[model samples]
Target chain A: MISSLTQAERGAAMLITLSGMVAGLAMAAAGRGDPMGAHGWIVLAFFALFFGLLVRAAYETEAPEDRSLAYYDDPTKVGILIALAWAVIAMGMGLWVAAQLAWPDLRFDAAWSGFGRLRPVHTSGVIFGFGGNALIATSFHIMQRTSRARMPGQVAPWFVLFGFNLFCLIAASGYLMGVTQSKEYAEPEWYADIWLVVVWVVYFVLYIRTLARRREPHIYVANWYYLAFILVVAVLHIVNNLAVPASWTGAKSYSAFSGVQDAMTQWWYGHNAVAFFLTSGFLGMLYYFLPKRAGRPIYSYRLSILSFWGITFFYIWAGSHHLHYTALPHWVQTLGMTFSVMLLVPSWASAGNALMTLNGAWRKVRDDATLRFMMVAAVFYGLSTFEGSFMAIRPVNGLSHYTDWTIGHVHAGAMGWVALITFGAIYALVPGLWRRETIYSWKAVEWHFWLALAGTVIYVFAMWNSGIIQGLMWRTYGESGTLLYSFTDSLVAMHPYYVARAFGGLLFVTGAIIGAWNVVMTIRHVPRQIPAQDRPTTPKTMEPALPAAE
Target chain B: MEISHELFVGFSKSFGLFYLIALSVGITLYAFWPSLAGRFDKAAKSILDDEDGPCR
Candidate 1:
């Protein structure tokens, strides 16, 4: 199998195999001590030799025409399939956890099934698996479309997909096994972290090589956001995960930073992971798909440049706000709060720009379900950014910091913003890529929109009320000025909100299922052929022509 | 103590007024300058058109 791999594929597979084998040997040798280190070295050496042979064999085959668009469509379709599947899994797990919170008995007595493990699982699944796949798939498609070039290699795209899913599996399983660094978002152990590093480096190279071969005079704004996401995420991942595992299988690791410094580093990684992974990557999608769907030029190109710089400069400092009122220095907290407030300007700028792109296209907003999804996503993006700034304020943090209000705030971005934009992009992609006239049911799309919108509203509002109630009850004093309520009182107060949240989650999940079915029927029933002369031609002024259909 | 606190509050409020005016002017200039320059260029072109005198 390795012998049939291309250079990029072989490089990726070798890195995975070498890292696994080295880690395995390291565990075994550490148990035995002395002279066993050489044995571990020998195993790595053999894999390295095998890797070289695979590369040679891979190069011996006759190379396919590098200019053809045939390879682009296949990988792009695979990415879409992977993204849709991950969306279901991620959202399903999210609803399950929501139910668990609503009724503690829903956990079913399994250790791994509890909210403790499932919380991270829900977060990582949606953020990394669902949202990350959307970013990769859309970036690949948009990059190819904007650059007007074929992707670099046939086999390399498959490597990225397989390697990424494999890393997700490792991270998810490690969370269940209790193999964590005890960090909030960076919980994956050393082994999984290193796996991501290798995958990301290949992704970076793939992006750069394709961009180098572009046929367009000016790179689209979407590509800039995608490239920024890829570059900044790589830096953040390496910095935050600089740790030494006690042993390969020990399930423990020590980060390089300690004390307050460690707290700072963790939030730095945490917040930027949201920035680059969640915010910037999805901004790339918004930049490309929103305008295309609306059939309008972007509202302002200059606003995009200003927003890009503003988000980059301010977001890095805003991480410290997450550690507010902690042992972190007071000045750091003030800096964080100030920058977070500043971040609102840029976030709103992009949101306003997206909304304004639909100025003359409001008919589509009423008619096209896809445009509605994107428009709602922009609205939620504005809402979430404002909420984020508010939560960063010291006084607000006192009440809402540890409450379900924060949970509602996060899902507003993830489910309402990111997932909605992704769905719109995918809806647009399916008809174009698969040559479908229309989806199976416009009625189903309408159902999905209402169900999800209602669910998000019910979920966020319940949490807001519950959060404030809990905050007030906790701070209340008796007639004699003694503490009025026990800590458990707040938990009791949250029960109704938790139940409402689960109901909201159920509606959202139902909508997702409807969407998945709609996509499936469209793919299965739609015709594949477009008449030769009737096919759309690539615009000469924008990008080079695609390869003639075989 | 109350009188001194009130006096300090009055001083702070006046200083805040000054800060807000300066900030508003700065933002207005930043937003409008580029558009103003574009208008100036358009005006200059019209003047050149008049100087060239009904060429056809």
Candidate 2:
């Protein structure tokens, strides 16, 4: 019976299984005096049923291909869209939060509007929502592209996307509702964490099966980064987020680790989260789209290999740098510092390789906004990595730690490196995937490039200067050896920088809106047709051919 | 008072010596291990090779 059913039918069966599990868990939790547990179970059930219905509906009918390319199987396109959308939202939220830091009274005291509440929303939105989506989308795309295989299942692709978004929704909502494990990065309550694990497992399975069916003899460099991302994240999530909720309706939970150990584990997961989610995933995008957009082969394939290994080995140890001068053992701090410094070499190697790929393609950088985005991203990647390494040093950490300087460094990577590369990939993909010959406006692309770049520079530099001044003020002592400036004094000093940062954010958001508009016009106004010749003969090395410049 | 101070100093010196020896050995192993630097070089080359040329 299962064999006779269509792909969509098979998906429905899995969803049914999920629903049953959720119902069972809920019933079990209801037996206890835990309202939170009951609520969690019900939420799980709702998702399962929703997915089940979707599967059933999908199996009952076939989609019209001419309407829009079902890019689920085309990992590259899917990855690009996911990355871009999340990057926009992430950066937007980040700027909002930055503004809040500048003027804490900016937002009216709505339950979800407060900085304490929305900060996690912004962080998770960017890190997991934007960053995580980027990893999954790129990994899927890279995996399929490198493997020379279509994605494994029709429903499976939707499962990854929808399930992931569902989890993000739950986590973000839970934060506002005051349901949390109270962990720094892993703030989602036990139920949300459990749901994520299930979603992640499906993601892993989808990637593995797709890879298994690959036509290519060997996987690409991007695939390695994606695989490492999936594997490391799975391990990290399970280990750090081990917790038990107090009750079902209660948003409280307890971690397995206590005191110093908890602190260590949190940073371990936190910093690596930045590494795998933000760095590794964007590196995958950089490797694949940079060369592809530039129409050039990578500069040195050997350098990519060394950098990957170097980053993987060194980054895990460097998480301790976040705990510099903490109660954590001094030896651990030393190790973190050492590894962080060493990381600079590999990080620079990848950045250098990306830059060099444009050796003969300088004209493309001039004409193609996509290539320009990628190039700018590469420069930011270099800057962020250098700043990160410097901050990991104990002496430097003493000054920059817990300051806006750290915030500046992060945005430099997120906005400048990750978001820029994501935008480039999206611009390159939008026209081709939607069957448009050209973007609605080349001028808009150029406008976005300059505006966003200027915004990023203004935002980062302002934070950097303010952070250093704040750090200095905090450290400065009077002749009597007492503290020179009060904490609020630093806030007063930051007002001008904060206003500049807000202006920069506004510019960046404007650029994003322009981009979104360009994409919409390309999708709607542009004509769509799959020319008979453009269809793949056997699905090996097939891509939509670029139209000649008009 | 002088004799007691000398004996206490001698005990501290012995412990420091053992710690230094252990530290040196650990450093030596980290420097020599193929897992540390060699693997990084190899991984870097592999990725770069896949990029500029055909995947192996």
Candidate 3:
């Protein structure tokens, strides 16, 4: 990675690394005898390790090659590897958490290993660690390809990738250290949030700089979604994390908003994090990789534009649906519900656009495990979005809210749509990125696909069953007009389902491990040969004469 | 004029509703504009022929 950089960029990297080390040292000194101090030591070690590498590489002579002749794929390559690593680690944490629930005594005798702490570790690890890394890596690949322009700077992409991972590291570690802001998704405290803002701004700037130099006059639809993902996520992160640290050196902080206002802001940030972070960014992947792999153009370009705008507009208002029947204003809740229901139009439109793009490619979908992953992802995207809209209605929310139903719904989207699409994209990208003819083993790909599908189906079904039963049991009335079942009774009833859920999670994690192994084997064994016509080209000024379809 | 809750709700109930409706219509129209269809189609197919390396 260091060998690819010009001497100037290497010098800049050293300077940045040095500054990061100093900051970490300062934090370590200031927050002594605290968890923040431990985090500071971690940060120092992290940058220090990088600094050591940078120093060792500093002696090497730089190669004189035109940097713009190839896409900056080193960061993307590293980012994908890091993402797969996090998928194994974090999804393994997910399985552990699930097991802990089924067998409550399954944890170690330590505060860090407790359910409350490890739960967020599992969450932030998967969401921000695995999912976030995938988005960043894929975005880098997609943005460059779609624009047909090289990334404006070499150092900035590295900065964004590593810097973002630093933030993820701090987040996952903080959760284990019992440090949090106690918010659902925005749990990372003030310092980590601030660090992410710095990283995110650089990411945004990198995107815009590349786009500004695009050879294509028309920005593709994928770039639009990616831009939205970056831009809106920054807004959400900053607004939701508006907090005052109890001490400048400590991890503890107080939120700017109070009570219902805090609830509203949190969910707004929370749900939109889902919208922009999970859905939109992955949708960007879906747009680019799905069609590219199928060797087909999008079915309706106009529908793509329509759905893009529709989702952008509708999803913002839909966050309040999470606040339904809460202390939040009834009207606001209704507004959220209304927009969430309206959101289905664009959601389905995009899903339909994807499926319709596969019209003549049905054979590919049938035969190719990678394509089937994407196909099933689109179906799940449609399914979960419909379920989301249905659940947002107040009466439905009354049953689904605080139940495992919400968990089922989220995983249906996360595992089914987001994770599946990511795996599909990764499989589609791997051989190409590595300059291999094809994957090392097609059988492994097929195995991973079926394993992932079975795991997701089993997990979702178990959650749905447990959720509805729990929701019903809670509301059930005896003849004496009392609750029919105690909470313990419900817990007892849920034991079997919990075991099933954990078993399903174990299967999912096993599939991810297999996928990771396959990736490694492919990289190791596959012979290197660049595909023909796989190089970027200069823009053609002359407009092509074509026959209009409509 | 002072911005009060009453004023905000009343304005939103009337003007906000109309404005959103208008905006939605405008976006829909912009997406479906007959002349722009070809441009959109071009955008869709533009990246299909992308190569792995940057322009030399």
Measured by DockQ, the strongest candidate is 3
lDDT of each: 0.75, 0.73, 0.89
Kindly list the per-residue Cα lDDT of model 3 for residues A1-550, writing each as its tens digit.
7887777778889999999999999989998988789889988998999899989988887765554456778888899999999999999999999999998887878889999999998888889999999999999998888878667657899899999999989998989889989999888889999999999999999998777767776899998999999999999999999999999878899999999989999999998999999999999999998998888998888888888888998898889999888888788899899999999999999899999999999999999999999999999999999999999999999988898999999999989999999999999999998988789899999988988999999999999999999999999999999999999999999999999999888888899999999999999999998777554445332321111110
What are the TM-scores, per candidate, against the unseen true structure? Answer: 0.81, 0.82, 0.96
lDDT of candidate 3 vs native?
0.89
For model 1, how does the per-residue alpha-carbon lDDT over A205-260 read when each residue is reduced to its tens digit?
88887777665545677888999899999999999999987765454689999999
What fraction of correct interface contacts does each candidate retain? 0.00, 0.02, 0.82
What is the TM-score (0 to 1) of candidate 1? Answer: 0.81
| Clashing pairs for predicted structure model 1, backbone only | none
Model 2 C-alpha lDDT per residue in residues A1-550, reported as the tens digit of each score: 2333355545565765576456547644663454355455656665666656655665554433431122243544454566567657766776788788778887677877788887888788877877776667656656655554556445566567766776787787766666667777788877667777887888888888777765454556787787778878888899999877665545567898999889989999988988887788789888888888877767876567768877876798789999989898787788789889989998999999999999999998998888999999999999999999999999999999998899899889878997788778678667766567788888989999998899899989988998999999999999999999999898899999988888888888778878877777777787775533222114433322111110
Decide which is better by TM-score, 1 or 3: 3
- DockQ-based CAPRI category assigned to the predicted complex of candidate 2: incorrect
Tell me each candidate's i-RMS in Å. 15.9, 8.9, 3.1
Q: What is the lDDT of residue A248 in candidate 3?
A: 87
Candidates, ranked, TM-score = 3, 2, 1
After aligning candidate 1 to the native by TM-score, how far in Å is the CA of A432 from where it should be? 1.4
